[model samples]
Target chain A: MVPIAYYLVLSAVLFSIGVAAFLIKRNIITVFMSIELMLNAVNLAFIAFSRQWSQTTGHLQVNGQIFVFFVMVVAAAEAAVGLAIIIAVFRARNTLNVDQIDLMKL
Target chain B: MHLALFIIFAGLCVAGALNLLLQRHPINSALSLIVVMSSLAVLYLLLGAEFLAAAQVIVYSGAIMVLFTFVIMLLNAGKEERTHGSRLAYIAGFPGAAALLGLLTYIFLSHSATFGQARLGEYLATTDDISRVLFRDLLLPFEVTSVLILIAILGAVALARKEH
Candidate 1:
């Protein structure tokens, strides 16, 4: 039997890495990918806790896993709209670098 | 056996994420994210989330990441240019990130006993079980998500179309 806390640690590490990438990366798409990383980390935590709770409660509640499904759906939808916007911005500005796409200048 | 599986896949997932962070090309980063997602699906399977493992692979790696790659190709997003790091970040970022990681690790390790050891095959979430709860209890959100996906598709097409 693996300790649930191990899973928590792994997810936490992944989440922090995602945050670091989000802050340090300059390209918008990489930053976006980091956001996806954070989402996946949260999903991991949800599934881990769902398993833990099911183990303790003996009722087998799958609410957390179901929520993971909803999160995935939202992620897919966000990817579609977000990448489309990125493409549109590239067309208008001819670049995908975040620093270079500063159109909101005073 | 569970420990071995978790260790290997978790290592792969972390390596993939680190690769994603290090890669300058968006395409490479997307590929690394795919690696991370697939490995996470394996982890979900270990946690007895069988259906989520499938959906994570299908939706995230198959659909969402493919979309990212397509946009990267369409945009022809080149390698990111080297940029000078701010002095504050150079001095403080490394220590801050390390401190965050250490704190999280400490918290999880300290609470390990509160969460009992997870036995393999202890609680399997079957597809029927998931469907029952999802369709019965979460029907509204399910329908809303479908609508959201439809709207996203339409919006993507509207935004990505060639401007006359």
Candidate 2:
């Protein structure tokens, strides 16, 4: 039997991996991807929790899923804007190496 | 049946994330992320979050991934740039990753031992329930937040535009 705890644990592991990748990766695009991975991990936990609690209500109490929906929406908007910024940054500086973009230094 | 499908989707998601990490090209990584997103959507469906699943497909796989692909294509980021980081990162990264995983394992184990298994019933909280709360109770805030996000999006685009 697959316990909800198992799913939640997997989700947490995935989220931690994403966070590690996000922090360690220098590639701007990869960092963006790590963020997406983290979001997906959270979504998994949300769905798992929703299902685990859905047994008593006869209907599903899936507020977590709804929260995931909002998260996805925000993530989409964030991606669009984030990529646009990255694109612009790449134009000014020929490299997407995040460590090299020191434009703020006096 | 549900467990089987969940396992399959979960495996696919994990595989896709690993591939994204190992792939040499940014485009390949983006594609792998899409696979991960799609698998997550399937997992959402299996968990009976139908609306969420559809939204996941539409938002993440559709809009967000498309944006990522376009950006990757625009940058023309080659394997060389992708791998240009310091060797120091790998040395430090491995231990950091290990520590995070260990911490997570500890937390999960501790929580698992004590967490109560709460049982909700059918129609516990559906899309309609969310709609009722969102549209009826939180309508103004919802609209305001949307407008705020839209403005931020436009502002970001404008700021990102190259000056003549």
Tens-place lDDT digits, model 2, residues B53-107: 7788888888788878877787878773444455666778767777877887777
lDDT of 2 by residue, A1-106 (tens): 3556667777877887786667666688888899989988988887777676665444556566666767776776677777878888888888888879878846
Stretches > 4 Å off in candidate 2? A55-59, A104-106, B82-96, B109-126
Per-residue alpha-carbon lDDT of candidate 1 for residues B81-135, written as tens digits (9 for 90 to 100): 8675455765687678778889988988998887778888868899999999989
For candidate 2, chain B by itself scores a TM value of 0.82
DockQ scores for all predicted structures = 0.73, 0.48
What DockQ does predicted model 1 obtain? Answer: 0.73
Error of 2 at B84 (Å): 6.9
Q: What's the TM-score of every candidate structure?
A: 0.94, 0.85
Measured against the true chain A, the candidates' chain A TM-scores are: 0.95, 0.91
Candidate 2, after superposition: displacement of residue A25 in Å?
3.0
Q: Model 2: how far is A33 from its true place, Å?
A: 1.4
